[model samples]
Target: MLFPASGHTKAHVLHYYAQIAPVMLPHVAGRPASFVRAPEGPEGESWIAKNPPPGVPDWVPLVPVEHRDGVTEQVVVDSTAALAAMVNLGAYEVHVPQWTAAGGRDAHDRLVLDLDPGPGADLVVCCRVAERLRQLLDEDGLMACPVVSGSKGLHLYAPVEAVSGRGASAYAKGLAERMTVEHPRLVVASMAKLERRGRVLIDWSQNASAKTTAAPYTVRLREGSPGVAAPVTWDEVAACRAPSDLAFTPEAVVERAAERGDLLAGLLGEGVRGRVP
Candidate 1:
């Protein structure tokens, strides 16, 4: 279905996952995945499949996660077979929480900061805001890695040594609020679009329990062509002129992983402490 736009076939997408599964699984395994499938094609309508749909093979693992109202079964992409199956099922994108299944819903393994451009702003502005966040994180004795969202912005992730969902949420929220106060010209923490005008929003809500960020190396279905949520270095972020500059297809992503290894692999281990008082 995507052959016309991206020149990629279903087989190509599956092969891409098959090749990158080794590196990708290390980051996604044991996490509750919210599969974003585009069965109709990149340009066609798509839906987010939270629970394992009917007819899923028994080999596919499922994790029961509690929500505000009740508990639901979420799929975990732990194996190469599972990843390829999802791709064959038209799951173009995979979004997972910062925690693992062993940690369940409480223990979070990482902290993420999503830098989104406001209404009047673009990705260039987003890059500037990300740089400021990196500097602040550096002062805190933490290391933050940048990942191109492959759409409109960048996401910064830092490994949290020993932190829970609550701790991560509070720390990220505080930092975002602080950025808005310290850098009023370029940053805003408000979720309101109006408040985001001419500024880049440091979205802090993704740190909460059960929240999911787009898994690295997954392809995003957007206008024109699909874009891969590829990991990038700080230098690439600063040098980028537009969002498309960081865009990658399935083929490009696999090649990138082969060359650079997993840029996000370091985030899987113990990192700087939250140190929130």
Candidate 2:
């Protein structure tokens, strides 16, 4: 099932993902080409490629792609060149019947935590880090969202401007860094892990305008499926199961969004034109 039908290597399927690269473009519309491909390896195959992959062994799906009668829709987007190409091709990120969002109207500042539990990191520790972050935000009356990384970790994000008048970026970086510094045992925001010893990165750097974190529902080509992320409320996170103990599936995620409506819905409709202001 992992093998591609007919005659395609997993590498070929990965290349196909790169060739498409239109899904991520629209979401990052206002930003410049800070987007980079996910990176290729020695054999030159990757769904996205911005850097040299560190022997990320040629990965094939652990599970077979389920048959849905039709191709499970997909979108690819990376790099400014890719964004331009997608627009030229008339690709757009829109509300599909399967995926829909509502409510983010009030122009609140957004700070998403791209929680990467690390390649070999412990999941229990990841959940603990998220818990601490939530406490810090709630004491300050901030609105945050928790999401599954779709790979190895969990992300915890809090809306800054909603509570704090300004200092949105500063606050996000400050909290992310503090999580690493304050709890040396649980977290790390350092880009270089060896330098950080052993710790999970809080990853608030994605808050910068020039940067863009993977949007919700976006796929990480490495994973067999779309690897869509799961968004959870602070209350849910408080109950605290464990990130490693959980794998938020695509069906569960879309289902959850449908039940609660999307927290980012209004933010998506904030009317920020793609053009630079």
Candidate 3:
């Protein structure tokens, strides 16, 4: 078993990926993916690998991503088999860019704002911050989708016409700065630990071309319960009053997807079109 806490075997993880692939692949396909591997199980050490390891199957898709060092082949999970294979390889989480690999590094179709709560704050605090962020986006005539980070906070994503990653990052940073200024009690744009005492950190820097976020439905291997980066409805967000309400397991996430379909499917299609003012 790869996850000792959950007692989930490698086959279980593989099945989870295979079952969720139909709804999850669109978010992963054609994107440069960085995986978190726990070869010795969740109780042991884990490492993040950006480059595709050797001996990957020929059918598995890979894209040559230029890093500061050089071009390295990055694995792109586009098929159910590829997804399952990655799970079998001890990858506990899938992280990807906001744009397709074909779009290059700078071209991003989405802007992400990470609502990270301080040590004193919690998920419910993040939920409130996310709703406020959503309201602001709506005021700007943009639509925002919220996803439980499966860790400590929430991630708000807005789809826009293809924009440069630098441009998107700048826009998000400006929005976060404005929010911090307007709502000092609840939002903090600065990364300084002391500044985050009672505020949620609106991490706009995630829009950078080199940055990545957890793919929706990807399972996370933490110390305690395994968490799934699951999509949630606005209603769910409104109802969330505790962190446990947002946390989901592999089986639970699969079941939720089966019953609710992909709540994040709209992001792949035409979404709200607007630029940050």
Candidate 4:
């Protein structure tokens, strides 16, 4: 079983990934990806893998990512078979950077802001913060889309005219700082735990070249029910009265994708590209 407590097995994980692959692959395909592996299930030890582990099939592509120390070969899940291989390795959670391997390493095609709720705060507060962020992004000529992170909080993504990773980070950080100053009670830009109490943190650091966020449609390795980082509509975000409203299961996500298609597909288009300024 991959999720022992929840009674979900490795087969379940593979099936979910297979069903979601078509819509999911485009978003993650050229990105340097990382995986959170729970070999003995969620209750057992789990680790993050940036480099491919041994025994990976030859068909899977390993993209090289350069760090200050050296270059690490990161796995890129470009096809359904590759995604299945990741699942077989006990990875339920996939994390990827804003920039893709196909695009220049330093060039970011999107800007992401992770809305993290601190103690005394919950998804309801996160929804409020997201709405405000959507407004801010809209004013900046960027169209923002919301994805319920499944673990906690939400993530906001906007398509941008290829900007440098540093530039994306600076733009996101500036927005967060501005929001914190304007809405001190509701938002906290600082990463400090004490300051974030009862507030939602606009985590802008994920835009850094090396940082990663849970890819949309990734299944989070959490307790209780399986939660998929499902993309959501603005209407759904506004209507999120309870956390359960946004919390989606793997089965639910497959069905939702069938009906709504990829809610974030607009981010892939060249049209409506927003400037970092």
Cα lDDT, all candidates: 0.82, 0.46, 0.85, 0.90
lDDT of 2 by residue, 9-125 (tens): 434434333433343333433322112242331123334322222332223111111123532222223354543343222121111111111212122245566666665665556
Alpha-carbon shift of residue 236 in model 2 (angstroms): 4.8
Judging by lDDT, tell me the better candidate of 2 and 4: 4
TM-score to native of every candidate shown: 0.93, 0.55, 0.95, 0.98
lDDT of 1 by residue, 40-128 (tens): 77677789888886667789999898888898888899999998877777887899998888986677778899888888888888888
Stretches of candidate 1 off by over 4 Å are 271-277
Residue 35 lDDT, candidate 2, scale 0-100: 22
List of clashing residue pairs for candidate 3: none
**Arrange candidates by lDDT, highest first: which order?**
4, 3, 1, 2
lDDT string for model 4 (1-277, tens) is: 6666677887888999999999999999999899998877777899998888778888899888899989889899999999999889787799999998978667899999999999999999999889988998999899998999988899999999888889999999999999998899989999899999999999999999989999999999887667899999999999999998898879999999999899989888889789989
Considering TM-score, where higher is better, how would the candidates rank from best to worst?
4, 3, 1, 2
Model 4 TM-score, all chains together: 0.98
C-alpha positional error of residue 107 in candidate 1 after TM-score superposition, expressed in Å: 1.0
Candidate with maximal TM-score: 4
How many residue pairs clash (N, CA or C atoms closer than 3 angstroms) in each of the candidate models, in the order given? 0, 19, 0, 0
Query: How much RMSD separates candidate 3 from the native structure?
Result: 1.5
